[model samples]
Target chain A: MANTNASAVKKDKKITWKEIKRQKTLLIISFITVVYGFIFCYWPLTGWIMAFQQYKPKNGLLHSKFVGLDKFKFLFGDDVFIKVIRNTFCMGVLNLVTSTIMAILFAILLNEIRHTLTKKVIQTVSYLPHFLSWIIVTGILHDALSSTGIINDLLLRTKIIDQAINFFAHPNFFWPIVAFANCWKETGWNAIIYLAAITAIDPCLYEAASIDGASRLQKIRYITLPGIKPTIMILLIMNIGNVLNAGFEIQYLLGNGLVQSVSQTIDIYVLKWGISQNDYSLGTAAGIFKSAVSIALILVCNWWAKKTGEERLF
Target chain B: MNTKHIKRSLEDRIISVLIAIFMIVFITVTLYPVINTLAISFNDGIDAVRGGIYLWPRKFTMKNYTTVLAMQNLVTGAKITVARTVIGTFTALFANALLAYVVSRKRFLFKAQLSFFWVITMYVNGGMIPIFMLYKNLHLTGSFWVYIVPGMIGAWNMLVLRTYMLGLPDSLEESAQLDGAGYLTIFWKIISPLCKPVYATVALFVAVGQWNSWFDAMLYNRMKTEYTTLQYELMKLLSSVMQQSGSADTAKNSTAAITPITIRSAATVVTMLPIICLYPFLQRYFVTGLTIGGVKE
Candidate 1:
């Protein structure tokens, strides 16, 4: 961003109408994007005012009763809201931890395979699930974990379980199932970044380590892991900001009456109240809380990254 | 040296065998669900409920696909999904690339300000309820344009395209300028052709997104059947089976031959078919897109 104009800094550069006229095409394009950015991106921000009001759809924003933070007061006071926050946090942490570890591990192990053709096939197959939407992924998950499904058959054949387990029916299983769903869908896709970072590592380090009689595990531990630490830290910090966005689609699609306690996320809560229950004000309040926390988290993480002399996002 | 070499080879061989086993297990786990679903879709719906169908369908039948394809709503959905994927992909690619070009130009004054303005949008959002309300207010609900307009100029896509364009030789643009080409002419005639790889990348991302999306359809166009999407239709079928246990009678009333499990599987298969067909093409472009090396002519 800072260096955009360095090339244009010539002595003959004129700050004149003729100069402006020369850039007419770009200016027009810029104006279109500016208008677009405001309309689609910035304009909805004004509607955040609904969070502070007893917003009625019929009355609209202007005529709606302004409640002065009453909706937030209700939200903070509600036990359901508190539970929803906890669910969002727990599932978020679970997803973050599992997805990160799996991606890095997959990348490292994939790096271990010396066979290029075989490695490419595995990597390509691994990314197959990433293209699938949560609807299909969760549908497949629902099928795979079903009582009459293959999982139950496998367990039954091994006599590991006397009977089938209703995996989705139990609250305890919901979080892990969500995490596994996230891992299945995303781990391979996320590994691409780590793989790129791993490839950028100096291969000579591996050669030198091997010459010193280092084992493969030792080489990976000493060389590959440290090589990708910066990438890990940068990605980890960026993800810290999105901690509230555990997921809506997967939970929404897979969740049922049985697991409702564990499955309701902030997004689902907002959708439930804002649209279904017609409690627009409460929904807006919850949305505000999410946005505020996200922005704050990003800022705090950015500050920490700066202090540690890491690659800061800003 | 020979003793050490022999010892390392023994260890390396053991590890290689272990890694091969692990890769085989990983591959099976990753591809099993998709293959199982495909098998179930081809299996007789009633026999699929008998519960032993593995890689191959025990009782093969095309009835499930036939039933799913026969639905009028699904046909509407498939059409809408195709329209959006094609329309959304082209428009978003052009719009985002154009915006990127506009904001990335060295000579373009206000480039920094415009870039920052869009970049900030990446981190902060107006939240869901407000955006829904805004859309409702703008009369975008129940309209097909809703899919295209709001998502036209993504900041991330714009940034990727901009970085790619910036990597191109400045001499090309300069030489074009000397030949009396305007910015628009250079953008269309010169820059866009050179942008095939990155364009392919963005196109795959946007196309897959538009194709696989169902939430927008559920949220905005649920009541508007004419504007339905294949994924949303599948979601409805999926949730039905989910609501009642997987073997529930959601489809039992229709035919004993087609159970909810096979119908849901078939519907899901239908919904994701386009993306799967295009997956090979997607794989080719996205890896290159994410790894930004300078393009050489």
Candidate 2:
């Protein structure tokens, strides 16, 4: 019995060694991937040191003189930074709320469509804008909102206004414009996930609602909405982590000096300080601040999701 | 009873009409602006300025496209953008697939820990400044590899691919192994073909991202004349035209006679056309791809 057990152990060891050797290619590929991650994603962390230093391009990060929290102090003391934080948060919240609601409504409406061909065509058209570059979308917005653009022409013909409104120039319209632009670009695309969620809801629930004499709205409120709550919660948690990212390109493109106050987010601030002004330390500090906030928001959202008995990101 | 049934049918008809109107208005709002820009790009210069072009060109001409294409650096920028997308997508998908395969294996030691590490990175990154400095330190500042290497590993894409991989039966791999086939063989021959939908979806995501990306090029690629990607090049062209037109320097630089509206529209159309053309082919995979990534078992 001892001899048989010993032979079996030897055989298992040999098989394991052969298996490792056989999987050498996969191991090598994975090593390359890990190395790539370390190099690009991990190595950049060294530059975080500049957050402490009054960094100059001439005096490289290694040789730069360190000043502790001066950049953060400057950022906090600046009224402009506070306004940017508010603008970023407000826009983020508006976008999150409106987009989610629009997406769900659109998905529900789409589900009610009886014609299969019409449903497919609308879905196709709606998602197309999501793929376009922000540069192009900004250009489209500029044209549509311009004095002689179609929107102004329509509004004029309808007598909605006595004159063409300079929508882009007004600070009051900045957040609304951003929110509307996001809705226009994303409502259809965002609806896809919700549509998928809705489709997965068992048809029996709808039948049960009908048998119980529930109207369409009641059925939607009780059955369809509840069925996709988990997906909504998961998506909400994931998007909360991105509350700080009010998009860099659209704001950068659309923003002029007139409405710069409302348009400048943390990202644009970092670009101005870090790249344009060449204050690497200040830029790094600002960036670190944004990341810290994002991490905290994500953790909070995850906790909320768990507490609510919904599917969490983790 | 008859009156109630008639009222219900009337309400249903009204609802259908409302829905149709809403969809029509939404589609027009979303699509017409883009299409109008395209029409504007093909219109005659004076007609384009008058802003009457809508639905179709007033005086049909390709003057704007030709002018924009003939600009000093447009062709080179186009080449750079195309090359970046192709190369970046290839490297990213390969790295993502390999990493995903390793993590998909339940028996792999440290699988859970590795997944957490990747997931954490997605929620919090070192931010752009640190990333720029890292690229500078590595001496990848002016190189094409700068675009490809830094963006190769996307944590979200990796996780999605890993989840898709996990959904596959392990028996396929075990049986292959029992037959003296290696993990590499199993992955290439058995698993890869099965994951075509996910692969295509991931490819579309990476390809579109790389194609549209101008931020990285703007940040690290300061060599304006030589290294500008297509989007950046178009941005510079428009901004310079805007500056020149807005300034007293127009007469001196009369070669760039393109108007703001025309140039802007042309740039928009050119940058967007390739991807728009590519989108329909990948539309089928998008719904499937999204559901796989989002829906938990």
Candidate 3:
């Protein structure tokens, strides 16, 4: 049987080509997948070679004059690059911490509600903003935060401040706005995974805890938190890779000249130089660095996950 | 015992009230901005600039929607967006499912190599410029296929689908194999039906991604009017409105019935209309499918 062959081949852990030849049809079918991976996923990697050269479109990838380490040198030397890195790191961490905490809190609280109808409605409504495009999300943010808009209008009525605070024009408020926008958009969507993990937790654990007179908060603290911890860790590990991403749209959409210093993430920088400025080589250099960091973060997280005896996303 | 029961009931009542309050706040905060945008979009543009529209239109008019819906490019953009979402989602699903099916079968030679090959992609990248250049080189740019071809096999979604397929009993596959079925037959007849939930989830992910994407159109299909997407059109309108605030004309205009604000809001609403309408129906599948995270194994 093919099953026995598969198990036997797997156990042998050697080139049992004769056994595999029996399933040659499957291998031939998968050859397309192999070739597809090279063209799309692996082929672009060859373009990384452009990072080493002063890449020119006219000359193309190969014929472009090679300037060894010059792009990286210029990138690292720029004071603006340092600021970009800082803003990305700061905003990334802020988003990660705030969104994760808010999502976990929402998930736990939603799970506590015994009424199914109310729970379903709230959960359904919570997912609305996540589904909206970032342009739409930022459009809402613009209207809500404009000088004569609701935030300013409310502030005037409540006398929080005598004058309207221009939210986007200021640098200090930019990071918080990005963080809040991210939370507003993603909290409910992210909580779905946590809630799913919670649902997977055995109901018997709860009944046992109840019999032992475990209070509601105690039950959450003892059972629910621990139960969802692996999901939390795995998600965290997965998200760590995206920490550098900081997303191009939200930053690019909400970011303006006034807050450019604070808002230009590495992604935006790549767009500004690579795509817009036509400094493809420098952009590739910056992107290569970003990819390097992302890969390193993922590897380190996987290592830690393995060390902690938790499910690691390799 | 009776005292403890009363105490417990009181605590439950208090917690329930608190949760209700929290949920009310959550719903309001989530819905207010959207509803406010809706109001501004409906209200007369001239009056909206005066700045009191919150939950409802002050001076109701259909002019904003009328003006936006009348744009020829928006219509074209809508066609392209719809085409891409449908075509992109189906192709990506098929391609990813095919590759995932191949690697998921343990009996397939080079299973680990094929899977980890794709999985490694999820962790790293070739950088954007290179990929863009690669697409350009391959003549994928300036065409509709640009949107579909490069993204046909998303590493992340394929990985998730493979993980879901792995959860199915091996016996289902083995029995199908015993019946003289090949890999494709086994995948179509046995595995595909069982993976409906995950497929739904992946489809939603792809569809929404395609629907919401404008950057591709901006990058590859920029010069082509026929290939422009709805999101890109809206983005153009939004950015124009956003950047034009520095000019005095936009601020000085007090008489126009159609202002940039109303136009922008209306276009945004129109762009988002399809996905928002479609998601509610697909919600049942994705919710169940996503219960198993990206990497369940």
Candidate 2 ranges with C-alpha deviation above 4 Å? A1-26, A57-59, B1-8, B240-258
Of the candidates numbered 2 and 3, which has the greater lDDT value? Answer: 3
Least well predicted 10-residue stretch by lDDT in candidate 1 chain B? B288-297
Query: Over the stretch B49-139, how does candidate 1's per-residue lDDT look in tens digits?
Result: 7788889998889999999999999999999999999999999999999998887677776788888999899887788888998899899
What RMSD, rounded to one decimal, does every model reach?
Answer: 3.0, 4.3, 2.5
Deviation from native of the Cα of residue B119 in model 1, angstroms = 0.7
DockQ values of all predictions: 0.58, 0.50, 0.64
What is the lDDT, from 0 to 100, of the residue A52 in candidate 1?
88
Q: How well is candidate 2 docked (DockQ)?
A: 0.50
* lDDT agreement of model 1 with the native: 0.86
Estimate the TM-score of every prediction: 0.95, 0.92, 0.95
User: Per-residue lDDT for A1-314 in model 1, tens only?
Assistant: 43655544642244678878989888888888889889889988888889988888889889999899898999999988898899998899889999999999889889899789989989988888999998899889888998878888899999999999999889999999999899989888889888988988998998999889998878888999999888888788888888897668888888888889889989999999998898888888899899898899999999997887786775
Fnat per model, in the order shown: 0.68, 0.60, 0.66
Report clash pairs, candidate 1. Answer: none
Best by TM-score: 1
> Which candidate should be chosen as best, given DockQ against the real structure?
3
- TM-score of chain A, every prediction, order shown: 0.95, 0.92, 0.93
